[model samples]
Target: MAYRETVKIRDRKAAQREALLAAAEGLVREGGFAALTIQALSARAGVGVGTVYRYFRAKDTLAAEVFRLATEREVAAVAEALQHQTDAAAKLEQAASRFARRALRAPRLAWALIAEPVDPAVDTERLRYRAAYAALFEQMIEAGVRAGELPLQSPTLSAAALVGALAEALVGPLADHQADEHVVQQLIRFCLRAVGAADPTAPEVSHEQVC
Candidate 1:
């Protein structure tokens, strides 16, 4: 009987933790990270303030989790998209397209995730997630080069460059909420060309698609 009671208690605690996290995420999605205070989170999550603190002792910890949740979801989407294609260039294009589209769909959240100033903990999360993106791109770039579909290049440097360029390019668009479908397509083309996927002779991604 004691074991059964303890199991129920653990299950309830897990559910409360999940609720707090979801509430934190909603706060970020609606109003950026500034609104993610413990007080706010508790009310939004329908839990007591102490309960929120019990789950996440600090705001930055919760904020970092929020960033990780969103970023990891995007990485998964891109990874899944890459799995459907065999061609290196197509893989790159799909990855870029999915990433841009996802950003455009949520400009405010994208801005917060990509470049918003935040606590050191949240920034650390940003760096980690950015590296995850770069690593995925590196794999595609390396594959393309070996297959002769892309020119010789340092996958490490090139992938890092691509991730940096794409994030920087979207900064203003996301800030101004100008991230339309057109801008998203432009980013896809720009990334593809930068990685040698847009060889002038072969030109897999055409100017129209790019523009």
Candidate 2:
């Protein structure tokens, strides 16, 4: 039937698109975004140039999709890590460490998602994702303030500053090589101190105690 043929064609196109994305991700993992080219990707993916063009009109569009996929994975990891920990400081520490570790594990992908030049539409979406992340930290900071553990006058600003600092310090090591856990811990401690935590060296505080 005509309808059945149309459905089969659509399914085949979907599979091809998925293949292109997978091939792009592999290229990015092996050699970074700069190494990705339509010709190379099409060849690697076993697709014709026209087939690749049918999926992504431009290289920037494909790059944006790649960035989106990478960022979604990182954000999900951060959200999952935060869910298991309740205390503000503890959650912050866990989140930072998890992010750093993930970044190091996928440095090329991280650099593409976070550090590379992206299309305007993709940049806007990225900003919204970052704002959501910032809001989660703000809530944690507010809980710390209520518990008399943090001296932050403005939770939003404090949360943003801490996140920005952690991102900046970790990005370089993530791009170039492995980051030292001790250094990551030290950065965590510094963030705790900045928020007016009495002693970063003290034993971990429980979520119940803070709540």
Candidate 3:
């Protein structure tokens, strides 16, 4: 007869894996992927280093997993923001603001996700997620063009450019932890102009309202 794992054993294993992942995420949040070593994860999770190995066969795999988990949340946020607004221009502006605001809110983690030097595996994930963001922007840009809300442009190129621009603009400020509402507001205006949308009537968004 073949041996089988019981329900209790499977549940316990799942819980342990989640705990390890949560601890790994916490370490990345506080100090970036540079701080996420198997031994460090063991200490944080209060498990043996060998246990971390059980969940993640290698360090690169672990780093990539953490990157994917954190970046998915950010992408979802921008997508959600886009959905909430009525027009293509408003959706673009709101999505840009939401992304910038969230990055400012978590500068350290944002820096890690945006520009940290890590293994090749993690870099691959970064490129994939950047494309994910661009895809979201591409849809909106295409809609705006069709609706006559935006000037004629190549949505693919424009969307990719917006992702690159937003990342580059925030890298310096995010690294220094100086990003704020002003930066977010500027980003919104920049994205609007880049996409040929109307400028925001308000000089700046109220920090009180945005944050």
Q: Which one wins on lDDT? A: 3
Candidate number achieving the greatest TM-score relative to the actual structure: 1
Residues 121-144 of candidate 1 have per-residue lDDT tens digits of 999999999999999999999998
User: TM-score for every candidate vs. truth?
Assistant: 0.94, 0.83, 0.92
Off by over 4 Å in 2: 117-126, 198-201, 204-211
lDDT per residue (tens digit) for residues 1-211 in model 2: 9999999999998988888998998888877777678988999988789989989999878877876776777778888998887677787777777877776777777666566565686676667667766777788889988987777579999878877777777767766676776656667766766777643346664554232
Q: What is the TM-score of candidate 3?
A: 0.92
lDDT of 3 at 158: 98
TM-score, candidate 2, is 0.83
Q: Model 1: what TM-score?
A: 0.94
Give the higher-lDDT candidate: 2 or 3.
3
lDDT of 3 by residue, 114-177 (tens): 8988899999999999999999999999998999988999999999999999998999999998
**All candidates in order of lDDT, best leading:** 3, 1, 2
Candidates 1 and 3, the one with greater TM-score: 1
